[model samples]
Target chain A: MAAADKVDPIHQFQIHPIIPLHIGGYDVSFTNSSLFMVATIVLASAFLYMSTASRALIPGRLQSVSEMAYEFVGNMLRDAAGKQGMQFFPLVFSLFMFVLVANLIGLFPYFFTVTSHIIVTFTLAILVIGTVVVYGFAKHGFGFLKLFVPHGVPGYLLPLVVAIEIISFVSRPVSLSVRLFANMLAGHITLKVFSGFVVSLSAFGAVGIAGSVLPLAMAVALSALELLVAFLQAYVFAVLTCMYLNDALHPSH
Target chain B: MFVTSAYAQEAAPAAAEGDTHAGTAVPAAEHEAFPPFDAKTFPSQILWLVITFGLFYLFLKRVVMPRLGGIIDVRNDRITQDLDHAARLKGEADAAVAAYEQELAEAKVNANKIGQQANDAAKAQAEGTRKKLEAELEKKLGEAEASIASIKAKAMKEVGTIAEDTTSAIVEALVGGKTDKSEIAAAVKSASR
Candidate 1:
C-alpha cells in the first residue's frame, strides 16, 4: 500500500461484451472489440463518404485527404500487382482502411484495439490469401501451383527448391497476420509499460516525480513511433495482398 | 505454439498477483482463455467482423469507391481541359499580336507614301510660281527700254533744228542783205554739216 499499484498492460486488451446477444446459438454477442470494429467501419466510411460527397473539381482539405487515401491505396495496388490488380481495388482499399483506421482508433485513450486480437488479424490475412487462392485456381487452374516452381533451378535440386517455395508460400498468411498483430500488440504494450513507469515512479514523491520525466519522455517518443507502426503495418498488409494477387495473376515462377 | 505459451507464462504471474485493476473482468475463471486467444470469443468476433467488415466492404465498394474515383477522375479531366484551354488562348493571343503588328507596319508604309506625294506636289507648285514671276519681269524690262529709245530720238531731232535756225539768223545779220531762201538754206546746211 505504500507504493503505487502495479500497472496492468494486458488489461487494455480485455474484451467486455457491451450488448450480449445470441444469434443462432452462436456467441455473436457484441463486444467492445466489435464496437470498435463497427466504429472503424463507420469512421472510414463516413470520412470517405462525406469528404468526397462534394466531389469538387478542386477538392477541399477533407476531400484531398480522402482522395489521397484513394490514390495511396490505388498506387500501392497497381505498383505491386499491375493494372490487373485494379479489379481487387475495393477489397484492398477496404482492408487498408479498416486496418489503418482501426489502428489509429486504438491509439486513443481507453479505446479497444480490435486488430490487436489474433482472430481478427488472422481473418484478414486469410481473406487476402483466400482471394489469392480462389482467384489463382479459378483463373489459372492447376497451373497456379506453378508459383511453387522457380524458373532457374537445376533439375537435381528442383524438389528442394519447390519444397522451400511451398513452405514460404504457406507461411505468408501466418507472417502477414502476426506482423500486424504483433506490431500493434508490442507497440501498445511498450507504450503502456513506459507510461506505467512514469505513473509508478511519480507516486514516490518529489524526487520520484523528477525521475519520472525520463519514462514520460520515452512514452511520448514511443507513441510517435507507434503511430508510424500503425500506418506502416496497414501498408505492409495491403502491399502484400497486392503481391499475392500478382502471384495469382502471373503464376509463372 | 509460440504466442500462446509465451502469453501463458507472462500472464500467469499477473493473474496470480490478483492485483489486476479490474478484478475478474478479463481472467474471469481460472480456465478462461486469454482474451485475445480465447476461443469462446472467436466466434463472436468473427461473426461481428464478418458482419461489420462486410458492411464496410459494401459501403466502400458501393458508395465510397465510385465517389472517390469519380472525384479524382473529374479533377484530372478538369485539369487537362484547363491546360488545353490555356494553350488555345495562348495561340489566339499570339495570332492577335501578329495581326496587330502586320496592321501597324502597313499603316507606317501608307503614311510614308502620303508624305512623299505631298512633298512632290508642293515642290511642283513652287517651281511654277517662280517661272511665272521670271516671265513677267522680262516683259516689263523690254517695254521700259522701247519707251526710252523713242524719247532719245525725239530729243536728238529737236537739237538739230535749233542749231540750224541760230546759224541762219547769224548769217543774215552779218551779210546785211536779204538773200534767196533756198540759197541761204543750202549754205547754212553745208556750214552746219
Candidate 2:
C-alpha cells in the first residue's frame, strides 16, 4: 500500500496475542479480544455483586439499576415466552449483561470490541439456537417439526410453505449473529474512518485544520449513535432469544 | 508491550510517520487484513467465550438471581401484610362508629322514655289532687245543706209557737179570755197546714 493508505481504518480490529499459547498445535492464545471478554465479566460481576450485596428494601441507585435490569429481562421473557419460560431467566440475563457490558467496554478508545468479532457473536447465536432445538425436541418430541408447517395454509401450497418456514427457521442464528456483528463492526469502522479524516486533514495547512472540525463533529455524533446501538443490539439479542425459546416451549404455531 | 502506544501507532501512520513519502512509492499491501475476519483466531475466541459465558451463567443462576428474587418477594410480602393491617384497622374504626351511633340512639330513646314517665306521673298526681279537692268540696257542700235544712226546721217550729201565743192573746182581748192550749195548737196546726 502507498504511505497515504497506511492510515488503515480496519487496523483497529486487529487481535494481537497478549499471551501466546499453543495447545496441541491449536492456537488458543489469550488475545486482546479475550482480555476484553474477561474485563466484561469482571465488571459485570462487580456491578451485580455490589448492587445486590445490600438487598435493601428501599434500593439505592446502584441497586435500583440492578433491579431494573433484572426486571427488564424478566418482563421481556414473560411477555415473549410466557410464564413458563422464566426457567431460562438466568441464561437470558447473563447474555444480556455480557453483551451489554462488552459493547459498552468497546466504546472506550483503544479497547477491543469482543462483539465486533463474528466468532463471539456466532457462538452466542449458536448457543441460543441450540437451546431452542434441544428443548424443543425434548419438550415436544417429533411434534417440534410441526413448527415448519403453518396451520391454515391451503393444501396445494403446504409443501412450499413448509419449505419457506424451514428456511426462515434455519436462518434465525445467521440473522441473530450477523445483526449484532455487523452493527458493531460497521459502527466502529465508521467511527474510525471519521477520526482518520480528522487526523489526515489536520496535517494540512491552516485551511485543512479548520476543515477537520466537520469530521470530528461526525465522529462525536457517531460515538453517541454507537452507544445507543450497543444497548439496542443487546436488548434485541435477548428478546430474540426469548422468542426462539418460546417457539421451543410451544411449537404448535 | 504498551497497548495504547501500539494502538495509536497502528491507527494513524499518517500523523505518526509525518508525511514521509509521496503517493505510490510504498508497496501495495493487503488492506483487508482485519484480524476479526481471520479464521485462525476463531477457535480461541470461541473457547474463551464459552468459558466466560459459562462462568457468568453459573454465577447469576446460583448467587445473583435468587437474591434479587428474594428481595422482591420480601417487599411484596411486606406490602400485602401492611394492606391487611390497614383493612383490619378500618374495620375496627367502622365497628366503633356503629357502636357509638347505636349508643347515642339508645340514650335518646331512654331520655324520651324518662320524660314520658315523668310527665305521666305528674299528670296522675295532679288528677289525684283534683279528685281529692272535688271530694272535699262535695263533703263540705253536703254538711252545709244538712245544717240549712236543720235551721229551716227549727225556724218553722219557733214561728209556729209565736203564732199560737199571738192567737191566744187576741182571743183573750176580744172575748172572755179563757183559751185552751190544746185547742189553740190544734187551730194553728190546721191553719199552718
Candidate 3:
C-alpha cells in the first residue's frame, strides 16, 4: 500500500482482554469493549456517589454537575415518556450515563470505542428491544399486538398497514444499533484521517508545516464536534428507548 | 379470502430471496468459525444482570428511595403547612364577618330600645299635662259655685229685713196707741218669706 493511502494513527483502536483465562476449550475473550464498559460503569457510579455523598442545601461544582445530569435525564424522560413513564427512570438514567462515559472515554488518545463495536451496540440495543417487547406483553398481554391495528381504517387497507407496523417494529433494533455504531465509527475515522495529515505534512518544509496547521485546526474542530455528538447520541438513544417504552406502556391510540 | 393468497404471496418472495443470498461468495467457514452465540459468556451475562439488578434494587429500596422519600416528605409537609395557614386565615375571615353581623344586630336592638324609651317618655309627659289641666278646671268651677251660693244667701236676708220694717211702720200709724209693738214684730218676722 502507498504511504499516502496508509491508515491513520487514530484508526489504531487497541483491543485487549482484561482476564486472559481460557476455560474448557472455549475462548471467553474479555475484549477492550468490555474493559471500557466496566470502566464507564465504575466511573459513572463513583462520580454520582461522590457528588451526592454530601447532600447540601448549596451544591458545589461536583454536586451541581451531577444534579444537572440527573435533572437533564429526568426532564428528557418526562418530556419524551410523560409522567407515567417515570417508573423506567433508573434504567434509562443508567444507560445514558454509561453511554456518555463510554463515548467521552473513546475521545482519549489511546482508548477503545466500545460503541463502535457491533457486539456491544447490538447487546444494548437488543436489551432495550427485548425489554420493550416483554413490557408490552406484560402490560397488555396478547392485546398488545393490537397496537398494529389502525382504528377507523378501511378493512381492505388494514392488512397493509399492519404489515408496515410489523416491519417497523422489527426495524427498531437495526435503527438503534446502527445509529450509535455509525456515529462513533465515522467520528473516529475522521479524527484519525485528519491527525495523520497533520503529522505526515509537517515533515516536508516550513510551507508544509504551515499547511499542517490547517489539518490540526480541523482536527481540533472535529474533536469538539465529536464530543458534542457523543453527548447527543446518548441523548438520542435514551429518548428513543423512552419512546419505545411509551408504546409498551400505552398501546392504544 | 385475503389470507389464502396473502400468505402465499409473502412466502414465495422470501424463499426466493433466501436462495439468492445463499448463492453469494461469502465463505461458510468464517460464519461457522465464530459462533453467533457464545455459551461461555452466557453465564457471565446472566450473572452481571443479576448482580446489577440486585445492587440497584438495594440502592433504590434502601438508600436512594429513603433519601427521595425524605425529600418528598419535606415537600409534602411544606404544602400541608401552607394549606393549614390558608385555612386559618379563612377561619379568621369568617369570624370577622360573623362579629360584624353580630355588632350590627346589637346596634339595631339598642337603637330600637332607645326609640321605644323616647316614645314612652313623651306619652307619659302628655298624659301628666292633661291630668293637671283637668284638676285646675275642676277647682275653679267649685270656687265659682260657692261664691254664687253665698251672694244669694246674703240677698234673701236683706229682703226679709226690709219687708218686716215696712209692715211695722204701717201698723203703728193705724193704731196710734199700740203699746205691745214687740209682739207684732215677732209675728211678722215668723210669717216672712
Candidate 4:
C-alpha cells in the first residue's frame, strides 16, 4: 500500500477491452492486447512485404534486415532440426516474428505486452507442443513414443530414465510459457519500481529531487537490459519451438 | 469515445491524489487478482493470439517466404553462373598460354634446324674450296719438278760436250792438238760417273 504513492508497476499489464463484444458466450472483446497484436501483425508483415518488394540482388538496409530475420530463423531451425524440419518453417517464422514484434512494440510507453500474459504465451507454447504431438503421431504413428525410450540404457535404469523424460516432456510447455511471461512481467515491474523510486524520492525536497538521479540511472540501465531481454526471449521462444518440432520429426532419437 | 474514456479513467486517479506525482498514479481497472493472472482477459487474449498467429503464419507462408526465397535463389543462381563462366575463361586462358609456349618451342626447334643446315652447308663449301686449292698446288708442284729434272738432264749432256771442247782446246793450245774426241767424250763420261 505504501507503493500506492508511486506508479503502479502493474498498471501497464492492465487489459480493458477497447471494443467490448460477446461472441458465443465468450468475452472475446478487442482489448488493448488485441490492438497490439494487430499492430504487430501489420508491422511485421508489412516490413517483410515492403522490404522484399524489390527483392534486390544486393539488398538495401531494410531489405537486409528482413533477409537477416529470414536467415536467422531459418538457420536456427535448420541447425536444431536438420533440413527436414523446414516443413515447420512457417510455424517457426510466424512465432518468432510475432513474439519479437510484440515485445519490441510493448517496450514503447503504455503499450500492452501481449506476450507478458500467461494465456498468450501458453497458447503459443501449447501450439508448439500440439504441433509436435499431432505431427509426431501423424507422421511416425506409435513409433513416436520411442522418444521416451533411450537407445542404450540398461533395462534396470530404463524405467527411471523414461519417467524423467516424460516429466521433462510435460514440463516443456509450462517452462516455455512461464519463461517468457515471467521475464517480461518481472523486468517491467522492476523497471517501473525503479522509476517509481525516482518519482517518490523527488517529492521530499530539493535534496531529494537531486538524489532521484540514482534510481533514474538504474531505470535507464534497466531499459537497456529490457531491450536485450525483448529480443532474447523471442529468440528463446523460437529456438524452443524448433527443438520441439525436432522431436516431432525424429521422435526416436 | 474509447480513447477518451480510457484517458478520463487514467486522469481521475491522479487528480484525486492531490500530490502531483503522476508517475505512480494507478490504473482504474484494479483487479482482485493480479491483472496478468486475472481470468477475465484470458478468453480475449487467447482468441486474439490464435487469430493473429494463425493469420501471421498464413501470411508468411503464402507471401513473404516465397518472395524472399525467390530473390535469394536468383542471387545464388547468378553467382553460380558467374563462377562457372569465370572458370571456363580461366581454362581457356590456360589453354592459350600452353599453345603459345608449344608454338614458341616448335619455332625454336625449326630455327635451330635451319641454322644447323646453314652451318653444315657453309662448312661443306669451305672444305670443298680448301681441297680444290690443295689439289691445284699439288699439280703445279709436280709439273715444276718434272721440268726441273728435264732441264738438269739437258744441262748434264751439255756439260759433257763442253768438257770435250775444253779438253780439245787445252790440248791444241798446250800439247799439240785436237786429238781423240771419242776418247775425250769417254773420259768426260768416266769423270762424271
- After superposition on all C-alphas, the RMSD of every candidate to the true structure, in Å, is 6.3, 6.0, 13.2, 6.1
| Top model number, DockQ | 2
> Which candidate order results from sorting by lDDT in descending order?
4, 2, 1, 3
Residue range with the least summed lDDT across 10 consecutive positions in model 4 chain B = B17-26
Model 3 clash pairs? none
Residue B2 error, candidate 4, Å: 25
Worst 10 residues of 4 chain A by lDDT: A1-10
> Model 2, residue A116: displacement in angstroms?
0.5
On TM-score, the candidate that comes out on top is 2
Residue A210, model 3: Cα distance from true site in angstroms: 3.9
Local distance difference test values of all predictions, in order: 0.84, 0.86, 0.69, 0.87
Error in Å for residue A243 of model 1: 3.6
Q: Which of 2 and 3 is ahead in TM-score?
A: 2
* Candidates 1 and 4, the one with greater DockQ: 4
lDDT of 3: 0.69
Candidate 3 per-residue lDDT over residues B1-193, each given as its tens digit: 3222333343344335433223221343322111113233433333333344345444544554344435445556878999999999999999999999999999999999999999999999999999899899889888888888888898877776666667667777776665365776677778873
**Which of the CAPRI classes, incorrect, acceptable, medium or high, describes model 2?**
acceptable
Candidate 3 local lDDT, residue A235: 91
lDDT of 1 by residue, A108-156 (tens): 9778899999999999999999999999999999999999998988999
The fnat scores of all predictions, in order, read 0.71, 0.64, 0.02, 0.74
lDDT of 3 at B111: 99
Write model 2 residue lDDT over B1-193, tens digit each, in one string. 2233333445454333322211211224423235667777887888889988999889889999999999888989999999999999999999999999999999999999999999999999999999999999999999999999999999999989999999899888888659998899999999999
In order of appearance, the predictions have TM-scores of 0.73, 0.84, 0.63, 0.82
TM-score, prediction 2: 0.84
